[model samples]
Target chain A: MKAKIHIMLKNGVLDPQGKAVGHALASLGFDGVNEVRQGKYIEIDLAETDRAKAGGVVDRMCKTLLANTVIENYVIEFE
Target chain B: MKAKIHIMLKNGVLDPQGKAVGHALASLGFDGVNEVRQGKYIEIDLAETDRAKAGGVVDRMCKTLLANTVIENYVIEFE
Candidate 1:
């Protein structure tokens, strides 16, 4: 199964990198852009046959290493 | 309007960062992870009211700043 993961900062967390991106966009003449939050998208291809097992593995991956629990949240999509 | 951008390296490109991530996962006992590709997810909020206009702006952003057109491909999701 292939799992796609989206990891992003929590709602209340400060994202300086996102702010920088916004500034860059503005400098490039993209006016009126706001609240630009940057995150990560990871595509993992696994050999597991069982969908349940794949979901469990991806959940563990998110909790353990993929997303920083303190500041980021992750969503896993099984395909 | 809000647009979600997913920027990723083109298939022919080598992703050392993703390889390193896979290695780290294996070290952490995620043994079944095989081909892992990493990318960037950016959530952009814009003042443009028209969806078409938002798409155009995001396309330009990807071309000029958000993504390296030569080695990366970007998908824009309008919301």
Candidate 2:
């Protein structure tokens, strides 16, 4: 099975990197870019064949390896 | 307009962070996590009403702010 995991910074968190990027974009002439929030995505190639098992595996993957629960949240999708 | 910019480490790039997370998952008993690749997503809130302008804005945003062309690639979507 193939999985795509999207991990993003939680609301109310400060994103210095995103801010810096926003400023850079303005300098590059992109107007009306109000804000930028940066996050992460993880793509996994699983050897398993069962779709049911894929969810559990993906959830475990997020809880353990794919996300830093302290600052981020993740969602998983099967592809 | 709302825009989503997805930025990802290019293929063939080594993702130490993702690797470390994978190891941590194995330690936590997650099985069959074959490989991991980490990337980024940027969500932008635009004040403009033009969808055509939004794409241009998003493209400039990615080129200048959302992605480091040396190490990453990005795509933009309107939301």
Candidate 3:
């Protein structure tokens, strides 16, 4: 199974990186950009084939390391 | 308009960060992990309302700065 995880800073959390990207975009003449919020996209290829087991492993991975639950939110897509 | 961009390294690129993450997972007892790859997820909120223009701007952003065309590929989702 393959799992894709999208992790982003939680709403209200300070995102300096995002701010910098936004500024950079504006300087590049992308004036339509209002805000840029940056995050992480993680793709994990698993050796296990069991769907439920793979999901469980990925969930645990997110909770333990992939995401800082206090400041970020994560969504997972399985294939 | 909101645009979500997913940026990933081109295949065959060495990803030390991903390897570290995979190692960390293994140490944490997550045995199912096979290979790990990490990338960027950027969400942009735009002032422009026209879908076509928003997409064009985003495409330029990707080609110029958002992604290193030589080593990465980006996919954009519009809303």
Interface RMSD of the candidates, in order: 0.8, 1.8, 0.9
In model 2 chain B, where is the ten-residue run with the lowest total lDDT? B57-66
lDDT tens digits by residue: candidate 2, B18-70: 78767776788776878877777778888888999878767866675567889
Correct interface contacts retained, every candidate: 0.92, 0.97, 0.91
- Give the TM-score ranking, best first: 1, 3, 2
Model 1 interface DockQ: 0.90
Q: On residues B1-79, what C-alpha lDDT tens digit does candidate 3 reach at each position?
A: 9999999999999988899999999999988788999999999999989999888889999998899999998999997
Task: List model 1 lDDT by residue over A13-52, tens digit each.
Answer: 9999899999999988899897799999999999897999
DockQ for all candidate structures vs. native:
0.90, 0.73, 0.86
Among these predicted structures, which one has the highest DockQ? 1
lDDT of 2 by residue, A1-79 (tens): 8888888888888888778777877788776778877777778878887888988878876776567899988888888
> Candidate 1, residues B45-65: lDDT per residue as tens digits?
999989988888899999999
lDDT of 1: 0.92
lDDT of 3 by residue, A2-73 (tens): 999999999999999999999998888789778899999999999989888888889999999999999999
Off by over 4 Å in 2: none
Q: How many backbone clashes does candidate 1 have?
A: 0
